[model samples]
Target: MMPRPLLLGFLAIVVLAVLWISNPAVAFAAGLVIALWQKQVDLPHISTVSRYALQGGIVLLGFGIQASQLWTLTTQFAWIVTLYIGVVIILGLLGARLLRMAATEGQLITGGTAICGGTAVVTLAPIIGAKPAQTGAVLGIIFLLNAFALLSFPTIGQALDLNQTQFGLWAALAIHDTASVVATAQIYGDEAA
Candidate 1:
């Protein structure tokens, strides 16, 4: 059974999240803070639940986007997306080699960087025979990066005087995770989101 204090702490976080927090990045940071405070509150299946929640949030965000707009944007920018992914992967691999990192770990990191962050890492982990420790490390790295992007992108976009379309495109291309990109865009405005 879960300890009473731990359970109360979790419940308080949930209540605060539901009642007050709206920003995804802030909510994530709050969770990180709570985890640090209660370092031993390990709940079984929490990872799986969090993963599904993230995926579901992304899906719900997609529903907000117009299908025609998505199709047009995808078709128009397909080449750019392909080229960016290729360059990032190649550069990541070379950087890993220069650092003399293991090939599998390097590939895992590159794949995560080039693709969808944790999702890419998790999907490739089993296929590439990555040890759990390696996967966890990569996920941690990606998660931190995503958090940074979420916090910084909007401020940078505004300081640079980027219009809604410009900021939206920049966020979509620059942020590693779809959810982060959307959240950053949302921070800018509804139009950007």
Candidate 2:
């Protein structure tokens, strides 16, 4: 293995590559591996950094929302939004039950699905007393789904020949995380929002 600092530097480069490739999920997983293998990088510090990123990410996420426009959207397509929320909730419940996950796992999964991603997961995981392994697995699953959403959602929009507005709505409703959703929306163009 390379020196710890060198390995850290290499991991940083890899992370940037993953981000550019729009596979932040892979970047996050790689980060975990590096921290585990090279304790000199400090697991706590890495975790703290990830938390800060999520916090900052969520704050940045607010920009994607348009409070004034939401009323119009709700009035125009209340049913669509309702159905989307319902499906997401149902699937989330089924996923947790089928996986035989703990209550906390269910909470974390649903919250992450319904709200933000890692931020929600991190906040609720401890509240529900989830097993570390279960929470870890849930986070991994969320990351993978987020990666798929970020990469494939644009293609899905194009393949379906969706209008920008339609694609934006779909991305916002279906994508697992705020950042991934916003990224997909942007892919459709600035007018998507």
Candidate 3:
């Protein structure tokens, strides 16, 4: 017999697939809803499966990119990304000091906003001696802001009449996480990816 969570998850995917063409975010939102709904349904294995699936998807997404294109992006955006990292970090440090937040919490939040999102926060968490609760709070705030950006970025792109490169670069520069950047760029079209 199929496990309840897996079965429910499949059903949710099937249902969401119909709406995916209209909005990929709907599928993402649906899956999040499913995970929330499955709180008591052996999430350890389910989450493991989810993580592996995402890993495979990320690998596949990578295969679609060309080395030459990567070089072009590297040359084009390297300095820009570096500048943003420095500025964002410095600004975050100043804001943290101004707000009088706990140093560890502020550093985690800064790492998250300035680098590769949750990965940055998680990487710096142990180094900075942040508690799990602090990590979770930072993640919650970052992802919530990411969700808002994910929704609004397309409109902003259109309003700016941004070309693929411009939109992708903006998303890469402004978005907090890699996933949100990828998703936002994919929306702008394949070239943006």
Candidate 4:
């Protein structure tokens, strides 16, 4: 059997190939494999880098959308968004109950899904005084879901022949994280972004 270092090296090459192919599904699989097999993961450094990068991207993305245009969108989507959020929360609660998840976990999952992904969970967790483990678990769950969404969303959009507006709206409503939504939308097209 190959040693761990050699295995990591081989996987690094594969990761480069996956990125060159620009296939999100392949990228995700490669990333997972690398994460599992790469012994020197530097998790803390990686987390810091990723968090800052994601935050920076979100800020940069905001520049593209005008405040006035955003207001119009809020007006258009506000009521339905609220209703949708409520339904999602209820459904999540029921699912959590059936699955026997902790109340805190359920609430965090619901807030993450029904609102702006981990951001909602993070914000609400502090206000509600959640335990650290609960917050971490919810954040992990949301990130996992976002990774899944980023992997398949573009292919689904293409298969369905959804135009920019339709795909953008779907990404906004369906995706858990702002970064995932933006990445998927950009893959679909700039107009979607």
Positional deviation of 113 in candidate 1, in angstroms? 0.6
Candidate 2 per-residue C-alpha lDDT over 83-193 given as tens digits, one digit per residue, 9 for 90 to 100: 777787788888989999776778788878876776678888878788788788888988888778867777888999999889888887777777777666766776664
Candidate 1 — what's its lDDT? 0.85
Candidates 2 and 3: which is better by lDDT?
3
Best-fitting candidate, scored by TM-score: 3
Q: For residues 79-163, what per-residue lDDT tens digits would candidate 3 score against the true structure?
A: 9999999999999999999999999988998889999888898899999888999999999998987887777888889999999
Tens digit of lDDT per residue, candidate 4, span 25-117?
A: 566677787777765654457688778977996899799999998898889878877888889999999999999998888888988999999
Candidate 1 stretches greater than 4 Å from native: 1-21, 42-44
Question: TM per model?
Answer: 0.84, 0.64, 0.88, 0.74
Q: How many angstroms is residue 116 displaced in model 2 relative to the true structure, after the best TM-score fit?
A: 2.3
Better of 2 and 3 by TM-score: 3
Model 4, residue 39: distance off in Å is 3.5
Candidate 4 is scored at a TM of: 0.74
List candidate 2 stretches off by more than 4 Å.
Answer: 1-67, 74-83, 98-104
| Superposed model 3: Cα runs more than 4 Å off | 1-23, 36-38
Between candidates 1 and 4, the one scoring higher on lDDT is 1
The superposed Cα distance between candidate 3 and the true structure at residue 184, in angstroms, equals 1.5
TM-score (C-alpha, index-matched) for candidate 3: 0.88
